[model samples]
Target: MAIKTKNISPDGKRQMTMQQFTAWLGRFDADKDGKISRQELADAVRGAGGRFAWWKCRQGLRSADSDGSGYIDANEIGNLVEFAQKHLGVKIVGF
Candidate 1:
């Protein structure tokens, strides 16, 4: 059987899959607590060739966090991608 995938880009272009996003989030969880802290998110953003100021990173983390938790999870990472896509007009394919 052939498997189907969903595209997240605005132009219907194929982008990173959910599994890939989750894997990337796993890599970002430096402390391996199944959650990503603001510092970890900032480091990951910087490492991914994106410039992030301390305050901006903190705000991003707060915005991406949906559950009101202090940390972000894999799902939150997906939301972060969408947020960046909307605000920055950049397509984040993966980590």
Candidate 2:
């Protein structure tokens, strides 16, 4: 399947700005709570054509859920950005 992405470049070599990255991630915020749940994150990875989405989600949540609230809030999204870039090849501009 074609890679589903809004911020990634055609050649996949450019970096996505934080605003772009968040807008992309915002698509998966099913509840519209302004926070990303584990399932939401997994869905995002899967939609991005990522492999091992659940595994990546587990690890991503582990590190990103700094408050241990089982949710990635605004403060924690920056953490998830790293995981997305590394595992999902999102290439966010900066952390």
lDDT of 2 by residue, 35-81 (tens): 99989989988987888889999999998999999999888888887
Superposition TM-score, candidate 1 onto the true structure = 0.63
Clashes of each: 0, 0
Query: In candidate 1, what are the lDDT values of residues 1-95, reduced to their tens digit?
Result: 11123654677443665565556546767789988888876766564445554665677777889998868876676667775454332455645
Report how far off residue 38 is in candidate 1 (Å): 0.3
Winner by TM-score: 2
Clashing pairs in 1: none
Model 2 lDDT-worst window of ten: 1-10
Clashing pairs in 2: none
| TM-scores of all candidate predictions against the true structure | 0.63, 0.83
Q: What's the lDDT for candidate 2?
A: 0.80
Candidate 1 yields a Cα-based lDDT of: 0.62
- Which parts of model 2 have CA positions greater than 4 angstroms off? 1-14
